[model samples]
Target chain A: MYERTIDDTVTTFGVSGKLWRDSMIMYDRATESLWSHITGECFRGAHEGAKLAVVPSTQTTWAEWRTHHPGSRILFKPGGKGEGSHYRRYFDDPARFGIHGRGIDDDRLAGKDLVLGVRFGDDRVAYPIAAFGDASVRNDSIAGVPVVLIYMKESEAVHVYERTADEKTVHFEPVIAENGLLMRDRETGSLWNPARGEGIEGPRAGNRLERIPATKIFWFAWQTFYPRSRIGGID
Target chain B: MTGTAVLFTLLLQASAPFERSQEVLMGDTLYSVLPLDAIPAIDEPQFVPVAVADTFLAPTEMIIGVSIDGDDRAYSAWQLDEHEIVNDVVGGVPIAVTW
Candidate 1:
């Protein structure tokens, strides 16, 4: 098993170009209006050094989820259509877990843990880990959509077991090079994008394009927002 | 209606002038719901002071404390020494104060 403590706490902020708006009122720094389209069930805090609450997705209606995770911020794909519904797909909801109709492929990942990191937009990225009882992720396009599978092994390395994003299929082997996570192709030895295509290099294939350090990613996002303020009142 | 307006205008003139002060404090309490009349538009990116007091604010392990008095009032005290609870990389409106 990959025995490592992953810092699951993440703080993601909107990119510079992305607009931040509150639907409750007109945009005014003084009034501190509520957000118009922010959704997803996650805990958010408002202190300069406040530990933000990371609300895990609970399988319930969006309204119920918001009651528990009021301050959670939702992340959208870069250049994505500003859709408000269907946030439950990405956000976790205990009630809706198995209801999505996607069952876990336990047989494929018989004895490994899969750790994956995703980079979205400029300063928004997250690393969510899920264990498969005994399943394997195949390197194939699912319904013509690209996806990557991470599998853990008892003795072998935990790796990007499969890559099937952007309509291309590629297999990757995880190697311990430079004491960091690296993905190399099993067949052509070409670098691969964990999501769609082969990356630039095998040893550190997705380092440049993706695979950013989780710590640096957090630091960059936290720095973008002004420290949480306690504005006494709005005039 | 005219009498009510005259009374309100008289009350406003009788009160002291409202002078605005800005400070950047480290805290996690949600102070956004304060009445709008108390706080006006603050200049974005202002480097206000962050302070904590013993009775008003207390610093515990990695977390600062702001006390809510019996009257349901919020107050704080700043630590004389400047300590960073959160890194300065996040640069939006930093306005958290804990007592």
Candidate 2:
């Protein structure tokens, strides 16, 4: 979720055994500073003012990932150490908030509701997981930059892309074709596959939409860090 | 200081009843939960081929997928829930895959 390189040097991180707003805090072995796992920013220690660069990632079903990246390497714990989960019970309880019993201060949505958050250049928005319903694609802008959000409900995947191509901003609508096409641009009628953002079969065939970094997270966690993040596309 | 100024304004507009003082995050805000590396990070991660992974990974289980500079990886949520972090080099870029 974050680039570990700092000042042209690679930094190794550890579980600091600390919690900030009920989230894990990682410590860099190089400086021993505690950094937020969610925000990637140092909150204490030698590197107090430093922050790690966020790397874009996707969250999806294992089957979907395998289908897309069959050659991809899978990270497994050595010798069966990673079999069980510590937070499985926590995940099952929608009423649970965090380590402490702190309730949500902002009632716009529930504390544990998952959301897809996108942030860049002074703009941040939290799209509730419930908003996607089944499969949905919508066009919107953040900080005045055109973008589209595509949610594949079955795969539990969400992707955001800048809908501009060849110096032109194009509006797109979701395609419900039986053959599994995802989007259609109003400008050129190019059908696009939201998963990869590539124009499938149309005037813009071979064109790809620039992907925007987004994260899937708990609403409480996202709100705790980005307290002012805008809530959109939620009922 | 533009980032700070913007953060200040955002904090002022925060709807949460909790007062998020930036000063506190630098002070007493962090609660020490356990000892250092109580939840150890996966340092030298080993990878399994898709065929090997399919035998264990559930079709419905969620995985964090990353593709950078032609190097693709899949980190299962189940493993991440336990380890919390995986420090790996992908496509010459060092990345920490944290849950």
Candidate 3:
């Protein structure tokens, strides 16, 4: 997701039916400049050097989203079929990663391994989704900063958060509660609601972990674009 | 994976839509084989309440959910597969919901 305004003017965008590193290239109606949908960078045209502001958003299942934002509205195409993906075949083909296939020289993970990519400052970390079960949580540190990753089985949405509350660090372990999957911090034995990033029980009640933006990405694409990214769960 | 990201990753790894010609910029393999608007964007998106959406959208269907300043909207994954992008305003911010 990106802000559409470029240099103080709002512009509309369209898919140019083009590719940049096998990623979709978007063009703005105002300048007709081509922009990389992956990086939100203008590659060609009047706004060649410009970029769209990255906006934080979540990708999840309708059921999960509806459960949380019960009153949320959804986009619909009129005079059209409801909703179904056109790339189901390609997505199922683990051997392929793009128009050119997985040509990146990294072998840390398979080309199609789905990962939750967390970016902190200039560095990024990847947590392989397959490493965890349907609903799971993991404690990790990014650049020495304590953090936690929560995976929602139903939605496959990964939520990341800074584990420091009140300048103190805490680690979490997944607990299978009757209601659903949740996290329990090791220090205070506080139960945490992953979706809300808050402490729901024990001594840490009412404490909230700072939310961190994470993107669900394929291993190959993340490697190709960010070679320096370290794969999590590798040890 | 969410439908939007599935579509996006597929776009990144699937075969090129059009024949590739040689071009390079910013360390990326570039191809402008197709003309502009080959896959039109939804400039004026129509939205419906969850009650209305539940009638059509599958429970497991993936969607991009954007919430800002208390205003929330979802872009269907299937809708993005065909259109690729949607220009809309959320939380008073003009934004492009791209695949």
Best by TM-score: 3
- Output the worst ten-in-a-row residue range by lDDT, candidate 2 chain A: A81-90
Best candidate according to lDDT: 3
List chain B TM-scores, each candidate: 0.16, 0.72, 0.76
Per-residue lDDT value at A10 in model 2: 85
Docking class of 2: acceptable
Q: DockQ, per-model, please?
A: 0.02, 0.36, 0.41
Order by DockQ, highest first: 3, 2, 1
Fraction of true A-B contacts recovered by candidate 1: 0.00
**In candidate 1, which residue ranges exceed 4 Å CA deviation?**
A1-128, A132-141, A144-146, A150-168, A192-198, A202-235, B1-85, B88-99
lDDT per residue for candidate 3 within A55-167, as digits (tens), equals 77787788999999988989977776532333433444667655434475688898768888877776688888888775488887887888888887744556889999779
> Which has the better DockQ: candidate 1, or candidate 2?
2
lDDT preference between candidates 1 and 2, better one: 2
Name the candidate, 1 or 2, with the larger TM-score value. Answer: 2
Q: Give the per-residue lDDT of model 1 (tens digit) for B1-99.
A: 111111122222333321121122222112222233231211221121222112221222111211112111111111100111111112131222200
Tens-place lDDT per residue, model 1, A1-235, is 0101113322222111111111011111222222111121112222222222211112223233233434332211232222232322222232221112232222222111212322222322222233322342323222243334433322111222224423445455555445333356665575543322346664534433222211111111222221221111101
Q: Note the Cα lDDT for every prediction shown.
A: 0.24, 0.74, 0.76
